[model samples]
Target: MHFTSVQCVQGENFLFLVNNADDESSFTYEEKSGKGPRSWGEINPHWQACKNGTLQSPIDLLDQRVQVLSHLGRLNRDYKPAPATVKNRGHDITVMWKGEAGEIKINGTEYKLLQCHWHSPSEHTINGTRYELELHLVHKCSQGNLAVVSIVYKYGRPDRMLSKVRRQICGIDEQLFHHIKSVDPKQDKELGIVNPGDIKFGSSRKYYRYLGSLTVPPCTEGVIWTIVQKVRTVSKEQVRALREAVHDGFEANARPIQPLDGRPVYQYP
Candidate 1:
C-alpha cells in the first residue's frame, strides 16, 4: 500500500507523492545508477530549474563572505505538541505533522510547520566543514512562500527527541527489510507526540540567511533559507539508525554543495 501526506502548501506536496510510486528512478542517491542530482534535469525537462536556476541551495557557507546584519530580528518559534506520523520515504525518514502544531515568525512573516526530514552528512557546509547529519524543518506561509530552517547535527549526547524518532525509523526499516506488513502510523496509538521546539533547543537568533531552491527536484527556487549557526547533537546510535534507514548500501543522501553564483548570504548576529 502507498501513502500520501496531506497537502497543506497551496494544496501541493510532491515528495510523498513521488516516492509512493514504485518507479522513483527519476531521483535517487549520488552513487546510485538511476537519476541523481546531476541528472535531475535529464529526468524531466521541466526540472531544468535544477541546472538553470541561479539560486540553488546546499551551498557552501564561507564565514568570511557573510555580511553581518543586525536587523534580521529574533526568530520566534512557538511549536506546540502535536500528533505526528513518521514514514520511511525510502530515501529518508520524514515526520509529517498533524493539526495546528506550531508556527515561526521571522521578518514580520509567520510560516506554519509542515514537516521535517533528515539528510546524512548535511547539505550546507560551514566554512567547508560538513557535519554528521542535518535536520530540515519545512515551513510555509499562506502566500505559498516557504522558509526552511536547517539544523546541523554533530555526534554527542543523544537527543531524547531524536532518539525516539530514531527507534521508529529503525523499526520501520526492519519491517520493510523483512517484507512485513507496512506499519500504519495513523492507527498506532503508541507513537509519541512530536514537538518541533524540542529540536530547537540551544539554537540562537544568530543564523545565516539566503535565497535558495529546494535541495530536491523540481528543485523549485524562491525558498527563504535560514541555517542555524549553532549545531546540535544526536547520539552515534541515532546516526547509525539514520544511515541504515536509507535503502541500498548508499552511505549518504546529501546533495553536493552548489555554487553560490553571486548570491548574497547574510549572517544575523
Candidate 2:
C-alpha cells in the first residue's frame, strides 16, 4: 500500500505508517536479482524513499557520531501478554498481537505495540560490528506514526521469546518445505497468549534513538527508531532455525545499512 505523510495530533510534525504486508516475490535480499535493495525504489513508484530518502534506517551506530543525553530518559515500555499468531512472511518470521497488548510512551506520545519481527545478522550495527540476530518491536500511534524498539542479540543463551514460538515456526517451515506452492503466504499459526515482555531488553537502561524509515518497502520514512544498547544473548540453534524458516533467498534477511545523512543519534541516560 502507498504511504503518505499526514499531520499528527500535535500539529508540529507529520508521520506515516507501513500498514500492509509486502509482496515477498517482488523483492529479495539477493543482489544478483534485479529486485534487490538497490532497485526497490525503481521497482515501485510508492517506494521512491528507498533510494532518495535522507532519513533512512539500519544505520551504523558509531560512537563518535552519537550525542549522549540524560534528558532523553530511559526507554519506557508497558508491554503485556496478548493473543498472538506467528507467521512466516517469506522474508522473516513475525509475531503479531491480535489485540491491544500494551503501549509505550515516548516524549509524551503513546505508540501502541502492534507486532514484532526478526532480522538475522542485524540490520543496524554497533561500532561497525553486526550481531547474530535482531528483533524489532513495532508500534504505531493514533496518527499512524511508527516507532520501533530493536534488541540486537549475540550467540549465548536461547532467547525466551523465540523458544516459546520455535515449534510454531518449525511447523510452518515444515509445511512450506512439503507444500511450497500450495501453502498460503498469509497463513498464521495461533500462538495462544504470548507476552511481549518475555522478549527481554537486557539490563541496560540506555538506548539509541533516531528518526528513520522502514527497512522493507515501501521504505516509508519518518519512523522513530530506538535501539537498545545492551546486546542480548541467543543460542546458535535458535538463529539457525529463524534463518531456515524463511525462503532460501531470504536466509539473510537484513537490509544493507543505510547512511545516516547527518541525522542525530541520541543515547539516553
Candidate 3:
C-alpha cells in the first residue's frame, strides 16, 4: 500500500491505510544496493518455486492480440519531491511522492487512489521494443484487490512536467537518502503531457492482462494486470535523466516479460 504522507490519518505501514503512497509498501528494494529498498513489512526472499524468478514483469506484448481496456475508473494524482538516499549511474535525482484521493472504476467497482511509481525502460514492451520509462498508478478495492494504470514513455517530445523532476534525475546523493525523510509527488500538471488520444483516443483499443507477479524482487504474483494497447511518449532526455537517477548503478531495472504459460492473456473488445 502507498501512503502519500505519514501524517495522512497517522499512517501505518502494515495496516494498508486505505490511501497512503508512503505506507512502506510503496518502497522497492534493489539487490544491487546491498541494503535494498525501504519497506514497512517483511520482504519475501523471492517468488514461489522459482528462486531466481525471471517471470517478474514488463514483457513485450508480442504477437498478442491488441485490445482496449474498458476505462474502469480514474483518480486524480499530484506529485511532490522525495529525494533518494543514494545515486545510481552517477544520478542523484530520484524522487518519490504520495497519491491523494483519486477515483478508480474497476469492472464497475469503485476504488480509491493508493500509490504510483516509475520503472525505467517501461516494463511492458510492444512487439518486443521497450520504451524509455513507464509510470504506474495503482488502485485497490476495499477488499484489497489491485488495479494498475500504466503509462509508457518513448523517445520523442520532452515531457515538460518531467522537467520538474529533472533535478532528481540529475542530482547526485552519494549516500542513501530515505524517501520517507522528504516525500511529495507533484501530480496533475502533466495531464496533457501525454498524447490525449493515447488514453482517451487510443488508436487501438487493445490490451493484454493476466495474473502475474511484480517486476521487482520478491516478485509477488497474483496481481491482476490491465495493460493498455496504446503506447505513450516522452523525450530521450527524460529517459537519460531516469537512467541516471538511481543509486544502484543500474542502467536498466525492468524485468523481462514472462510467458503466458497456458494462462489466457485476455484481450478486450
- On lDDT, the leading prediction is 2
- The digit string of per-residue lDDT tens for model 3 on 21-112 reads 22223334453543233321234432231234333354556665444334422322232233222112121232222333444554555554
Q: Could you tell me the lDDT of residue 207 within candidate 2? A: 93
Which is superior by TM-score, 1 or 2? 2
Full ranking by TM-score: 2, 1, 3
Tens digits of lDDT, candidate 2, 99-215 = 889988888788899889889989999999999999999988887778889999999987888776754444444423232222245787777888888888877678998888899
Instruction: Provide C-alpha RMSD values for all models, in order.
Output: 6.8, 4.9, 9.6
> Model 1 residue 231 lDDT?
88
- What digit string (tens of lDDT, one per residue) describes model 1 on residues 103-192? 887666788888888888899999999998899888887866677899898989876666555454444433232221233322322245
Give lDDT per model, in order. 0.71, 0.78, 0.45
Backbone clash pairs for candidate 2 read: none
lDDT leaderboard ranking:
2, 1, 3
For candidate 3, give the lDDT of residue 34: 38
Against the true structure, whose TM-score is highest?
Answer: 2
Clashes (candidate 2): 0
In model 2, which range of ten residues has the least summed lDDT? Answer: 1-10
Better of 1 and 3 by TM-score: 1
User: In candidate 3, which residue ranges exceed 4 Å CA deviation?
Assistant: 1-56, 65-99, 164-206
Q: Which model is ahead, 2 or 3, in terms of TM-score?
A: 2
